[model samples]
Target: MSLLNEYRIRLAQEQDLRAALEMKLQAWREAYSSFRDEGFFAHHESQLDQQLAWWERGLAGGAQFWIAETGDGKIVGLAGGTPTIEEDQDTGVDIELGVLYVLKEYYGTGLAAHLMDTVLSRRDALLWVLEGNARAINFYTKHGFVPDGTSEELVGSWAGLREQRMVRKHG
Candidate 1:
């Protein structure tokens, strides 16, 4: 209740990896439990290793990491930006909004919006939301992300699900 209101936001550091990753997994499990199969959640541990790899890269890449933690240092949410400086086949510089996860307890409490607002405020960037994830699609729309008519299959087991690429440019 009031305790949740006192949460703070800051850049995530190396030591926060364990808490951050755990928060991410908890958020995902809660968000997609209804949409995905029971077997999916039951067999999801292998995916954690892959996620750990990416989190490690984020730690090593020096990209900005933002986290929302309670007064007790419990991480409730996280968001980050992963940028590609190299010229791409399509867009010039690709800046990916790579992380946005909030614990289930905070999902309806505006924490998602808060994390997203902070992420977008950092810079102009693009992100992909799985087409099947209706909740995320609506969330991104409210944040000023409109469909660019571009999509792709996200690598890995998500290859079947369409990934909608949306961008917000700041002038």
Candidate 2:
């Protein structure tokens, strides 16, 4: 059977935090190795524990985190969004797609799209993607998001990386 057909998506809980973090790490290692500088991983490694805790707290706080799981029970992808209003009044977008990552093994199987649709559910939203992440840019574009001309340089743990904002509007 096709890998795409062998998986399902559902809301993520506190119990799924560690596996979701692993999937995020694996996806980042595989996908961003070329897009990010050589020191990216080394700089970010020390903060992964904090990120994991943040994910757990976000879940507890009612952020909509979702995971894609294989029939055999392995979690392969995750996506989440948060309600946004005050900070993005400039764009008028009310939601932010904060995280979307999938294991490299599922890159071509449409799992990322499925995970996104599960969490965002076609809502009009905004997201920041790494400036040079062509694969992600293309994917978001395919889903109707367009660049909104905002960019920022990440500092500290993700120093040297840049990001641009993309937005999709309600139809």
> Considering every candidate listed, which one attains the maximal TM-score?
2
**Model 2 pairs in collision:** none
Q: Model 2, 1-171: lDDT tens per residue?
A: 778998889888888888778777778889888866657776666667898898778777777688899888799898888777576768787788988998888888988888888877778889999998999999999999999998989987667889999999976
Q: What would the C-alpha RMSD of candidate 1 be, to one decimal place?
A: 2.8
Query: How high is the CA lDDT of each candidate model?
Result: 0.75, 0.84
Residue runs of model 2 more than 4 Å from their true location after superposition: 37-39
lDDT of 1: 0.75
**What's the residue-level lDDT of 95 in candidate 2?**
80
What tens-digit string does per-residue lDDT give for candidate 1 at 1-171? 554586888888878877788777678688877656666665665567677777778679776789999988999999977674453225433677877988877766788777777877746677778787888888888777766778876655444567787776655
Best by lDDT: 2
| True-structure Cα RMSD, model 2 | 1.8
* Model 1 collision count: 0
Which ten-residue region of model 1 has the weakest summed lDDT? 84-93
